[model samples]
Target chain A: MQFQPADVVARASFRLPAADSAEAAVRTCRPLQDELRPLAVEARAAGPDEPGEGFTVEFLLKLPAPQSDDVEGVLRTAAAPLLARLGLDAGKLDVDVEDRDAIVWAGDEALSKGGTACGAYVVHLRIGRDPDEPHELLPEGSLTDEEARALTETLNSLFEQRPVEEH
Target chain B: MSTPAWWDELMSVSDALAAADRAEVAYWRGGAEDGREDSHEDDVPPVTLRLAALGREFASHAHELTAEQQHRFLGVLEDVLRTGSEADGTAVATGFFESLLNAWNGGFDLQAAWAGVGAESQACCLDLNQFWGIESPEWMLPRVA
Candidate 1:
């Protein structure tokens, strides 16, 4: 991850970490590289997203084939196995899938509390890697600097923080 | 104003779908609490397919809907987002909102259709990308609080 300036705004398409639990997720939930499987899916860090050796994980929503009932239930079910397989919990890390081609971001801990999980096609949280990337995380040009910092700080901390477990 | 027949059918199906969604969420919640790893996949999962069916039906007549009807269509979904469970919100967004939003993109005045709803619903429209990557127009984007 590149060094982030305070003014850098992140325009992500997935649910960001809740302002409250972001620090906790970063510190407690983030697993070491060995903990997670090798990121085999193609990286979606396009259009100014530089992966910088960081990885992107594809959250595939495994639903009961052909049954379209309780999507949230299905996502919840799919997320636990997937997240558990990755050693992530719903609080610090839970899975929620959007519609077709959408994968609930493993980085999204905000709605993991009580809300249903939501996702993107592929999650590449290039939050602050590049400075000029105008964000759409919020509305066009509507994110106050304070909101931007609060959001990016959590995401930046996701990669920058050390994994104490590995040590 | 009196509602259109097709709109009524859509609303009826949506209500049924919402109830099924709640039941399904509860069922999964129960299963999770029981500590079972997909013990019930044997039963047919119908929500995803049902939504696709609704989409096809909605699309067939979606272009004919008036802006007022659009308001009503979105209003029901908006209410679900507001009053339903978190699971319900996700369900409506994924199932109904995604379907209707796609139909709107094909050709309906979403802004005009969204006119009757409150700022909250309008904001919901703007946040489609947050759900499954439904990109909203620059004009439809709301000012974040």
Candidate 2:
């Protein structure tokens, strides 16, 4: 089966290792950002929240696949390179796929076979906090803005730390 | 006895045929062996052996397979890759064999590609060289990922 386009995004928060602010974390993640780009995939970064106080990132991925099911495994595979490049280890990666079959073609055989006839195939993905995992401070009711920020900060710090001794 | 060109082609074809048989066997074995239809027979040793044979044949006749067969082979590879990603490894592998059979029957130069591969690990390289149309198995190429 041919794969349609795919979109993937992951968000998380962690404190900076030496730095006290989210800016440094943002900077660190910046260089590694392009690594997340899938072939024919677009990527954008949004907010550490409150002008620049907390670290919260959102990634968007688009892939070329016929079904939503086509996006997941590719997204997962893409994550490995990002982790290495960012020097950031993920506490949680919330991956989501959206089949953006907004338009349909009138004459395409694929459309007859159930694929959208027109417009680009799209898959939207989001990965962030996991409510199931217990947190020390946050009372879970979905991550509040502040809680999400805190998590982002923690992730930043964890990722920013130096690698251990390699013999 | 040193391998002859026809012998190689026949071997490759036989392998493709065997892979088809294994895939059928795997489908049938799925329910009873795993209890949940969890097994993917495509990746099984038998199927891989079959894909290897086709790869050897493709290698042998690289020039012949380079024709329109290249595109068709790429299509099959994509299917194999996608299925392998979603389903069990064996099932995905088997899917490639099934696809290879389709390409072979369709008149693609599967034997040439299989034959071109060097004797050493030519069989093992079928899955690996799937894209450039070299050592790749006729079952897998042009993968989406």
Candidate 3:
């Protein structure tokens, strides 16, 4: 059977020295999401109580199965120019497609597990993905050469953490 | 003791904007883990400095807030950050005030959802980065705790 455009989920994690550094990273990443907005039916921003630090961002990109190979390929291509501009490393890049689900939920559900205000405000797809015959576009794996190089550079500054300030 | 009317009003507006921003971003990100304060610094618009100031004012008065008052304070905080600025700021502000018209009409425990701050009341704080199928910030795992 031919693949349809909808079964792709991109979940990525980032580590910075401190929460503030993470915030900077997210800001840097926003343009990436904005660029994908037209291509993907949905896009969003999610993280825990703190804005920066160690955060995980997840977004669903809808792509045709014929272009399934292009899913990761596109990300790899996208990562290069962007990461290069930001000066981050591609080798240390942490990106992949971990699951195949019909509907992709924005934000991590784990935060709410402890009865905390951890609800990062999960953003639903601006457009929902089809459940039946969902097309799983990208699978978790290594990024292309360019992606690797760019990610390694981005990581150099993006993940460098700082001390959390006392409230 | 009664909190100042102006303080209450400021709290209400600040909370509304913050919650709205938070909800909208989360919705867009597709339910990714969020809680770190650092993540928001970039996402928030420059105008948000106004709201942040209000948040600071609210925090300063934290000592004066009752348990219920504090809960209400935190409850709206989530909303302001999640959905406030993305939507029409003026409209959101108006809705917040309108909701407060009968703020106590049918509700008293709006605080239930936001009872406290810190880890117990917050989402997971992120300190690491992963992308391009590789994880970085080698110090992240050890620092998380």
Candidate 4:
């Protein structure tokens, strides 16, 4: 199944050390535009709010399946130089990747059974955060049965169920 | 006009959806004559006022909504956003309603989302803080004051 361009959305927020100003945050993040320029469909950095706690930078990329495995690594690697430039600690960064293709697969499954998929086809993954949010179905069509099963297995693996406690 | 008892019954997904629809219609009616000299004494649209009331009410009773109700409400909200985007002219009331929907979604700190809603509303020349009776600008943004 062919995926659309810009189907992958990667968002990263960096919380600067307490004393950082909005100007400093922007200056630190400005290098990312040059680093991600080649891979991005669209990219932007939202300036830090007045308190200067943090700021966010987002990228929409048209990555093919072969490059999927290295997404997080690429994100971290791209962010590293910027962090080093700003003398910011890596621990303060939060990264999230949304796989629109997986949502498309889920949506197709729903639509095949005559169910409607609402809104946009997007799957939000907060990188290191717990997976508790309900997944939404993407709008339908495409993907082989084998591919669908594999993707389903991958998604299912992300959420581990805890054993129930007996009273 | 007195608030309907059905408004309190909005814990049901179906009722919530119906309330949203009714609120949208009422908002449009009020917004239609917004700048006219003959506009009603209550300059704020009934939908905007009702949604703000609903936001407060829903926040207090949010836990009462079933998981299914929360999921369905999110879906309904996405539809509302889609409809708002497709309209020839986006309405400030729509942004206000979106803020209420985000508040109802809960779980995350909604300051940033609220800020975006406020910015969108003001871009359309509506002062959400004044209309919603909000005092702090920080409440609209993600920053904690």
Candidate number of the best TM-score = 1
Please report how far candidate 4 places residue A6 from its true position, in Å: 10
Candidate 1 residue-wise lDDT, A1-167, digit = tens: 13322211111222223311111221222232123322111112112342221122222121222233554444444344444443334344222222211133334343343222432222222212321233435553567989889979988988796857863
Worst 10 residues of 3 chain B by lDDT: B124-133
In order of DockQ, best first, we have 4, 3, 1, 2
Indicate whether candidate 3 or candidate 4 has the larger TM-score: 3
- Candidate 2, position A79, lDDT: 52
CAPRI category for model 1: incorrect
Q: Comparing 2 and 4 by DockQ, which wins?
A: 4
- Listed per model, the TM-scores of chain A against the true chain A are 0.27, 0.28, 0.25, 0.29
> Model 1 — interface RMS deviation?
17.7
Question: For residues B1-145, what per-residue lDDT tens digits would candidate 4 score against the true structure?
Answer: 1222333344356564455445543453445423446544322222333444454444445456555665454444344434442221122133334345445446534443333333334333224334334453444443435
The chain B TM-scores of all candidates, as shown, are: 0.50, 0.32, 0.31, 0.35
lDDT per residue as tens, model 1, B1-145: 1111233444554454444434543453355423356544333222322333354445555456565665565566566668754433544444454555666767745555455655655665566555445566776776667
Local error of candidate 4 at A16, Å?
4.2
Candidate 2: residue B55 lDDT (0-100)? 43
> For each candidate, what's the DockQ?
0.01, 0.01, 0.02, 0.03
Model 3 Cα lDDT, one tens digit per residue, A1-167: 12234333232223222223222333444654565432211112233553333433333334323234444454444444433333344443333433223121223333233111321222211112422334444334778988878777988878888889999
Candidate order by lDDT, decreasing, is 1, 4, 2, 3
RMSD of 3: 20.6
lDDT of 2: 0.36
lDDT per residue for candidate 2 within B23-133, as digits (tens), equals 544443444323345544222222232343454444445454444454445444444444433222332233234334445556766555554322322332354244224
Candidate 2, superposed: residue stretches over 4 Å from native:
A1-142, A159-167, B1-70, B82-90, B98-111, B115-145
Task: Using DockQ, give the best candidate's number.
Answer: 4
